[model samples]
Target: MQVLTITTPWFSRAQEICAKKKFDQVWIEIVHNDLEETFLEWVASLSPIRIGMITESLTYSSDVHEKEPTLEERKHKVERRLKYMTHALVCDEKDVGYLKTSSRVLAMWWTPAVPKRFIKRQRKLASLPYGIFIGSVYGERSKIIQNPELKELMIHQQSPEHGTPYPFFFDKMHGALYHFLKSRLPGTKLLFLFYLHFLRAIRQRCFSLWLEALQNGCAVICLPHYVKTYTGRVVEGMAAHMPVITPDIPDRPRNRALFEDGVEILLYPENDPIYLANHIRRILSDPGFSQRIVEKACRKINNFHTCEKRVQQILNWVETGEEPVYA
Candidate 1:
């Protein structure tokens, strides 16, 4: 009955979910320095046995708040925390990676489960293009934008306005709205549309950028590398019927398409931006080719391994302590 949830001292959906299931105790694991006792106190208010698992690592003290931790400092801290947890729930690869190396309790990504009705809703919603990507970008890790060709396709123009979230979000929104309205407007100039789309990319987040790009002229989306392992942004994008351009990474055992390469997803040769761009242009130019891709994507989305069916698997994991079966 003693269960522990070890996470950065931030607000966690996993912690709330675990609490709703009534775990006997929930612990928030944090680094030793620059620790917030208030977060621990909040957890204590939620559960009787809340505890803080502080690692032996020297993180930035509040006095050194402006400084970020060195790579070595982070590794040592993570290693120490790995040794501290006996039974724990984890939400990211870093946590899973740590668990794999340590003798700590088994870890789970604690991914969100889709409701049955939501699956049906998503199926209906899938016929239209819908794209979304949440969470901050760690430096140099965006799969699509990092590619020279993909970046050329995705980011039309750069904004000198950096860092502030409000300006970025608003600028993107205005640009998208202008382009969206222009496309519908009876004599909207092509040059005007191009200008709007370029400005949009500079201001919007990843998903919004995707939307704006599609509005201007793009037709396909590459698989987002952002989501954790078990979750499939590819499936979601496919379900929405956007022809997807994905990388052929051998390590990705779960997303291997059972169908032919072009029919399922146009899997490009490893990191060949020219090949990727060529395939992208092919799909955009050929209507029949694009439809086939959309059909295949929708087919894959409808088949087994949907979010709705995964709920039972998640529940089974909570109740019976087993890894959910992948269909």
Candidate 2:
């Protein structure tokens, strides 16, 4: 089968999957930070599978926006291109409604290089002296960081501690620019191309989100996902064998059940920081509990969330037309 993936910035591990799948026929479209797109079409009449995926939405959730020139301006165009793809593979299941065909990769999926020895080491250090929550602070998650326990450990991209990025909070002028660009940019979208160049020139820096994510791989975050993206933050945490605590989404019973309530992950209500705090205290005080949760979570990722395994999922989805059955 000719498998084509139209994705945003590609990862080294994920890029390797193409070589393993089908070498020559794969088409990868690069969209700019959810900001814009570069397009491609089939050189042939038939192509078996075309996947539209943006892992940066999960992997590089923090700094991607700082580098992103204008998401507000480019989102419609970028999203339209993704909508055009044969299969739209979103990192989270909630985003399915917006696209034509959607497949959820589930659980902040990522290509992890975690060593078994590291997990063993973590098991020994089951007190889990340190904890962290890194990434964008979207929705009520801002409130999550305010908890005295989480507040200290929270490392938000928008926070001054890292670097202040003026990404999501756009004004009316920017909004007008988006409307004008979408409506006025015509034909090959020459104006749009120029805009990307201008945007990149001003925004370019030594910022590397993938590197940062790699550096801070051991992070614990739990929240009610209000938006479309659920990054690989959860996977990153588990890869390092850290215990996870987060709010369970009411709609996704399967996701809630992915881990045992206290075994694999600790679930808390969205607005309740007291519950979140209580879970953390329990883990910190109970070394056995933390080890059990971390071990099981790491084992689950080893079985299901690898890059090779995720790619294989799309192939199954295309063949069977059934929801991904996470075991």
Candidate 3:
């Protein structure tokens, strides 16, 4: 009947769902400092039926120098919290099997709505020479930037407030559009206009930078982590009608079902920058192929992954105590 969620940037999607459902009570605890204590006390007082969001502990299978919490400790935290709640919702599907608790585990994906204004503005400007990377630089991303084959491929790396340091190559090469342009064009005057549009998106907070990239770029390049979790940017790209290229994520059933190779998306094997670059080139060279991919992806997101549909499915499960089947 009521829902309580922690205030985190990632949890905004869950909060939107709560607002749409018009739940009896929606309490959000501001996580300014001491997240654990603030969250624990709020949950104890409210004792809500379904706790929708929580931050996942950072863990690595390999040995690391940092003093990270052990897997058992993280499980204990979940078990402690589950005592007062009927069901726990996690954004990542990998956690569903990792938690291994008695309480019902609802695997929810982050579904961010694409504004109609952005859709209307898409591809209005002349396509730029470069692609865009919106997230942090790490893992496969670091490797992709370093690959020699992709040297001429310009990527505007938009680093978040809390992200790993940019590699030296990226730092050196990233500058004005004219600086990176191998040759000047007759339409060189329009480069500043395109840059201004990018700056406006960041200033106005109209849509995410990646969505803006989908609007301006020839194609969207997403290098997801090796983990099986679904990236919300992929859906945002589809909604913007941009052809997306990313690594294969076959471990999770929901993701495997949602995307098909060369149909809804183009999937490459992990750690293959050569193949990734080739995929990018293919999409750029062939207009008909790119159009087909985006059309299929847009239809899928409209019918299946909209925020309204996701909220209704969650409500159905809460009321009927049965999982809603996904097609």
Candidate 4:
């Protein structure tokens, strides 16, 4: 059976896995109406399975703003597209609702690369001498640094002896931006593209602020995720028994679970920056509280983040052609 992927498989390990399994047809779906000739040539050289997909949305025009399809119009277009494909594979729950009724929409999670050595290492390095912040160091870090009230609490204040590296943070943003630019472009949607660029530039400037915080003895280690887009830091932090603080989105169950206060995870909503600052301060100042969360998180979820397990899950999904059956 033919497999049509809306996104390009280039540089995607997941694509490598899918291709290795021998899908009869694999479409990259570039979406460049003006560059159709270039896209066609590009796909011709790649595996015969690869194909290009274009939409009017890819064209650039002065009236693009007026011509922009509304959410309903876009939804209709997606429905129309679904009529042509055999099975539609979506990356997350956000896209699941948009797929057509007849299409078999499967939510695919990127398979994380957890080094076997890391799991074994975690068993030995079970004690977190420091707090860890694995992902982006965006406005998120300001909760601790910029909030004077939080500093007054001394709960969020770090001693000068505990300097951790900021390369991890910089690397994460770098990887994230690289993926972002490759996945999107100027003509896709002007405002969205511009906002993405603005956010990236903000992060770029924030890199120095992150380094300054680290120099002042922040315990956060900004590290590169194993698979560029996957949440490797979350798993790695849990493994290290480090108390982690990531912003929570109310709608996602897994994200909400991370904020089950005074338990394995602590939640902080970004809207109330002061509250987030206070939460960070509370953990920093109270050693017992911080240690408790780390211990609980390590015990509650270590086995689930294993790379071997993640690989097996991906392989199982590919083999069964289904979403993961999580218990």
Candidate 5:
């Protein structure tokens, strides 16, 4: 199938990946309705077989940005895109619950295992016991991640050193790292874009940055999005063999799908920091327990949610056009 991403934002993102390009998944962002017009115009000229990835930050319930499209407008765009797309991917199983289509594929922001060489290199220079938080920081997203305990953690590292990766407190703070790298490295924009785009997966840059932090031996301090979706950064952390401390991010549809709370991952309550601090303390103080959680998380991620496994699932969906039974 021919993909006309030439004029689309995806084309620019495609330039970053160094790995040989085999897959040609298209993105149909809910935020960028203007791209839909361009994409449709291109599709009209050539019958495009659209395999779209729905954006992860789909908080369509309210308009956060002044220019953000309304839910009805977003839905109309999605339906129009669906008219040409063969399949679409969503962050959660019911993520596209409102979209009127049967081609929806339940995919998290899952990623393949990070290259060991990357992890090995990061560990060599890692400052141990640091925790990294990626994703939005203000308003609702902030409320969810920065409870009393997480706040203290962020404050402790408030004066984050140049290479330090945590307290990535705000949603916008993630870009700071990218800019930092771009300025320091000078002529390696493509390399950063490649990894940022790869995110060790292919969806969001924050996940890739978070994975880099994990590779550096920093623990992941996070909670699932309040949008009832599991941000798959947890999967990346687990896959990287790093300990993950999070709130009770539910495993929907199946048991142990996202996590097993205290087994595959350590769980804390958002309201209480004592539990969060204790979990952190346990990770730092006890080596065996930390190792056990990391091992279990890695096993679950490999068995159920790798970038490879997700791609196969999408392929199977494309052929059958039937949503697989959630395992």
Candidate 6:
């Protein structure tokens, strides 16, 4: 069978799967410019049995008033696209309901391709006395710097340029604050690094930096976000065997089902930096507790959230016309 994936940004996971030779033929068409036209053309050229992966909302009009598409619009776009392909793969489960009654929609989780040795090394490095925060200062992430509880924490924040190429932009006020803090408190242990480019360079730089941060920190802290999806940071943190603390999203059933609070993962109430700090301290002070959580999380990742496993799930669905059965 032949598989054709039409995706935006061309995430590494999609690229890896398309490279496999097991499929009679595999082709990936990235929507760089003129997204709607390119998408329609690809669907017309590909066979009906082809599997198309939609990484982002298709209804996003470049002419919008610099505002994001509403949930309804996103769903409508997804539903419209499903009619052109035999099977569709979407990143979020929330968008599945938009598909046609006869459409086959597969809700695929974003899996990381972390190596075992790298995970082991991160665990060893996490023995150090520090914590790391990996994200930007935009949107809800601004709370991280504003929270007084995080002021004294020996945290290393790595803000890389977001992967998507878009026109929307935000102020760099947090960058100025980061620099001022560094100068004001010369003795402070806070560290900051910035990448000016997009995700094309991420695959090359992200793992090493992530491993370095995980190795140097006792835990990883993810700030709250409006979008409740399972981000790459959470998966990467689990693979590194580092206890991760992030806001709880009750609406996201996949995350709720896959992770357990105070067991395989840690969840915090939104915008509560004190709770975040407390969790970090708890993990650092109790080595036994930290080790248990790390072990459980790593086991979960190995069993369900690896790139290899996700690929098999996709293949099974395409072949059997059945939903993926999770353990």
Query: Model 4: residues >4 Å from true position, as ranges?
Result: 1-92, 100-105, 109-113, 120-145, 150-232, 257-261, 325-327
> Count of backbone clashes for each model?
0, 2, 0, 6, 2, 1
Question: Any residue pairs clashing in model 4, and if so which?
Answer: 155-281, 156-281, 168-222, 168-223, 169-222, 259-267
Per-model TM against the reference: 0.48, 0.57, 0.67, 0.47, 0.61, 0.67
Q: Per-residue lDDT tens digits of candidate 6, residues 39-59?
A: 555444534454556555343
Candidate 6 TM-score versus the reference? 0.67
The TM-score obtained by model 5 is 0.61
Better of 1 and 2 by lDDT: 2
lDDT of all predictions: 0.47, 0.50, 0.56, 0.43, 0.52, 0.58
- Candidate 5 per-residue lDDT, tens place, 207-247, comes to 44545555553567665344345555566667667877766
Q: lDDT rank, highest first? A: 6, 3, 5, 2, 1, 4
Q: Alpha carbon lDDT of residue 167, candidate 1?
A: 71
lDDT (Cα, tens digit) per residue for candidate 3, span 261-293: 888898877678788778878877887998898
Of 2 and 3, which scores higher on lDDT?
A: 3
Higher-scoring candidate on TM-score, 5 or 6: 6
- RMSD values for the candidates in order, in angstroms, are 14.1, 11.1, 12.7, 12.3, 8.4, 12.2
Which candidate should be chosen as best, given lDDT against the real structure?
6
Q: Which ten-residue region of model 1 has the weakest summed lDDT?
A: 114-123
Tens digit of per-residue lDDT, candidate 1, span 236-324: 44544566666564444443533357786777654466776777668656868877877765665556445565545544554577865
Candidate closer to the true structure by lDDT (higher is better), 1 or 4: 1
Q: Could you tell me the lDDT of residue 130 within candidate 6?
A: 58
State the lDDT at 64 in candidate 4.
37
Task: Give the CA lDDT, 0 to 100, for residue 17 in model 4.
Answer: 29
Off by over 4 Å in 3: 1-34, 37-39, 54-60, 63-80, 100-122, 159-210, 325-327
